[model samples]
Target: MTKTARLYKIERLIRQRQHVSFAGLLAELEVSPATLKRDLEYLRDQLGAPITYDRELNAYRFEATGGGSALARSTARHELPGLWFSERELYALLMAHQLISGLDSQGLLSRHLQPLLDRIHELLGPGGENDSKALMKRVKIIGALRRPVDATCFERVGEALIRRQRIAMRYLTRTRGEVSQREVSPQRLVHYKNTWYLDAWCHQRERLLRFALDAVQEATLTDTRAKDVAMRQVQAEMDTGYGIYAGGTRQLAVLRFSAQAAPWTSHEEWHPEQQGRWLADGSWELTLPYADETELVMDILRQGEQVQVMAPDSLRAAVRRRLAAAAALYVGA
Candidate 1:
């Protein structure tokens, strides 16, 4: 039998018996002891199956904790189809997994992603586990907000966004020190840097507004329903600002990057319409249309001297004003 066929048979035998000795596995697969041992090792490491030896039972058994064999089987079946994913879809899935894993670790989300992980492994094939581990080790999600977040508030906002429900929230505004209540139709939940924000249409204001989820002191779902806004329209509005608050009409913004930061900046997809032009001086120009400035400010600030806003006097003025305020902290020095 082919190695792949033999491997599958070995897996089936283990599933049927719960545990099987090396000799038994060899007999089942009609393979030699040495070949069976090699197969077991491959299954353990390559396939990420938690196979362990039981001295008392005199056999190899699946780990009682987090047995992933069933997940693996489901994953294999899904990948058999000729379904193709675009690069963006793949990246989005990866990011989603990373976020879910983080939430799971914190007890905010249930550990229900075993099947998804198994599918990822199957899609990745033999080298999937290694590649995933390596990629996760290097990539990290960081929130730009300086304050600590309330996990409950974050989860609530996400739930509301998913359910397509309007929410009544007590929000702490930056300009207003006191908490204000508003009924909002949540359009999207966005994570930028380390902070989470909800883009919603305020029923009171009759306009779109972005609320920092962490700043939400209370959020109660409302029974009153509204027309579901298209994600594209919401995104188009948001691209107008730096963060989530898209207060004005959409405008095109241009940014010139210093040579040192151009390479790293080019690797990111900042927005759907983002386009980059490499300059002769080794610098780069990135142009994209945006409707908001809140998230954009944080992004530009993160780049420091490696980037400069080239167009839209309003955005430049916003950046300059923020820099001046930051400089105030050093007045004593």
Candidate 2:
């Protein structure tokens, strides 16, 4: 029998019986003693099966506490253990891997996922050749407003988050031109539009805060344990508002997209709480909740004349001033 088929059979035999003798496996598999020994090792070590030799019984039996046999313990969970995937599933997973790999320029994500990816490639077989690579080349992912992050900072932040420990950081905000030292208990790491953010409990503010990973000048894991904030409070503090700035009162901002921009804006999801309608004039009207107008204004500005802030006098006024300032630059030139 082939190595793969024999391995599967060996697992089935051992699992079905209370104890399986080496001679029994040898006779059934019709393999040499050395080959059977190697197969058993592969099953125990690589597959994480808790197979132990019972010298008293001269047989192998599954240990009470199975180490990591996904196949043997498949019944406990509703998943197959043998790393099996359909061709289409493999393609989808590879595409996802490609998308993430392209966006992970810092190699932080790629480094951790390399093992699983390697296993997938092995499963695809040598016949696939460069299919995965070619498919990756065919797909492209582009990012806007992505910032480079220091490896050490990312590593330290990840460590603190995993250990539920506090992190000391030197953070720089674009609006404030100086670095501020902070001790934060990281609740979760967020990746939005290619930028990394940490939703954390700010020790100084005594409240939850969001810190952009790129703006983190320095980060060090602390010995202190992180203060646990309720999940509901975190959601209320961070997920209720539009975009990343979700800390304040959410205000509804009404926007009108010109007919020229309707094609693009019609399909876009501005926000979960957003309400939109198609106007008779071939234009689109959208209203979304936002805590801060800073990011919203930037997005609208990208559309140039195609978008107009129709309601909330403050937002409308803010957009007008920014546009005027931008237009003034070309006046003298």
Candidate 3:
């Protein structure tokens, strides 16, 4: 801790306790009695205070001079709020400060938060510069979204989520090759594989759906609100799958992994309900219960020759049919 930080903590302790003994201040500030006395003298002499030790109180008491109250004088010298930050919080604060500072230089910091940033700078003590730089080097947070969403849309969605309001959105569906408008009760925003998605209850289809934020061309708030029962249902449905997409029913998905992929595959958590067993032939048997096949198929295809679908004949047939079609394309070429 730096001198300024120690002084700030001392000031906070004094204010909170009204009067603090030299021994208590020494323990809290972790400073020698001579140092604490010097600090007190400095506060009294330089800062214009009548801070003196009282035998009856057995602590230092701030006397009110004719000019102003002792509390007011000490506060005027340093008004920064003394907050105890955990390591995780410190890292988060450092990251946030870096982001805002970068955005400020680029003329993009939010107007509402600029004043708050200035106040933060005042609270940061002498060693804060070096501490912040070291923290920035050690910590990092990455956004998963491919492209940044429009700030305005992002703000609106956040507001909608807070208010629990339904939204009518104009969205482009790449899979269906269609642009359609639908009224959906916004449930939650999810991030997966660097993309942002909005999970909502579709009024038209009477089902829960997840739509990519980028795919949304336009959004308008609706007067119709989501019922508690519907929201719970959507939550329950989404919780059943690995990602946002969930099928109507759950199925047992079995996969066989080659020896080469077994070690890597065993270490990962494919799903919450995933279970794996080592086979005698140096292969691995893995089972995951999923509500959707779309995401599962993608997972299997990514493994290529290292993994094979074993059970739920439908999934195997789908994988084989897709692979055969892909192979036929290569043969024709």
Candidate 4:
């Protein structure tokens, strides 16, 4: 039998009996004692099944706290990895992996998780020349307007985030074209549109601020511990507005889309609390909150004549100014 099939059976047997003797597993699997031992090890060590030998009970059983490493213990709440994954489920996992791998443009995450990915590949195609690898090879994921990030700098930021440590960084604020040295307590790391943003409590600013990792030229972990903030305050400060730039006092921007753009824009979600409705003329009207106009303005400009800012004079003016500037570039062209 294939190793994948045998592994599935071992998980099933242990779960069904709650405990099973080594002799019984050997008999049921019809494998040699050494092979059975190897299988048990693979299940516990590789797959993190949390199955341990209860010497007193004289059988192998699931323990609430069984693991071979810190990584294993972290995932103890999950069932055995890929033991019961159907072909369709395995395909979903592959698709998700591809999406996430694209976000990690530096390939740091993919390298660390390659072993599990390889196991999934093997389960899908034991011969190493199968449809799974071929399909992945055929697909191309393009992240539009992506900025390259320094891998070493990003690693330092991630390490501080996971270790809950404060970091000192030299940041270049593109808007002002100035560099500043700041100490920040890393709170949350956000990945959006192929970029990494760290939402942290800026020690210098005495408030929450999100820093683009690419803009960060230098990051060094500090001995100070990260100041813990409640999730509620974090969301309130960072997630209440539209798009990636969500913060500050939110003002609703009402937009009307032309009939030509309604078909596409109607299905789009601008924010969590967005409201939209189709008009009698086949136009679409959408209302969403925004704290910053940087990203929001870019999206609105994309719609061109198909969209109009209907409320909040400030946003309307911002769009108009951007449009005027764009038109100026094309004058006499």
The best candidate by lDDT is: 4
Model 3 over residues 3-101: C-alpha lDDT tens digits? Answer: 555665666776677778889999998888897887777556654545667687798755543457656643333333424443345446657866544
What number of clashing residue pairs does each candidate have, in the order they appear?
A: 23, 0, 1, 0
How far is 121's C-alpha from truth in model 4 (Å)? 2.7
lDDT of 1: 0.70
Candidate 3: minimum summed lDDT over ten consecutive residues — where? 101-110
C-alpha-based local distance difference test score of model 3: 0.71
lDDT of each: 0.70, 0.81, 0.71, 0.82
Backbone clashes in candidate 2 total 0
Regions of model 4 farther than 4 Å from truth = 1-3, 10-84, 124-129
Residues 1-333 of candidate 4: C-alpha lDDT, one tens digit per residue: 656677788878877776789999988999999988887887777666788887876987777466587435423443666668866677777777776677766786767677877878866545432767776776668888787688888888889989999999999999899999999998888888787899999999999999998899988999999999987998898998777886667788999999998999999888879999989999999999898888899999988899999999999899999999999999999
Model 2 vs truth, CA RMSD: 6.5
lDDT of 1 at 196: 60
TM-scores for all candidates: the values are 0.58, 0.77, 0.72, 0.78
Q: What TM-score does candidate 3 get on C-alpha atoms?
A: 0.72
Give model 2's TM-score versus the native structure.
0.77
- How far does residue 275 in candidate 2 sit from its true spot (Å)? 1.2
What lDDT tens digits, residue by residue, belong to model 1 across residues 41-136? 877777676677878889876666543674353223212121244333444566677766653234344245666656665544454457666776
Per residue, candidate 2 scores C-alpha lDDT tens digits across 1-333 of: 545466667767776676789899999999999989988887676667677887877988766444456435422221125445555577788888877776657887777788878766654544443787677789988876678778789888998888999999999988879889999999998888888899999989988989999999988888999998888888878987777787677799999999988988989998887889999999999988998888899888999889888889999999999999999999969
Candidate 3: Cα lDDT at 215: 86
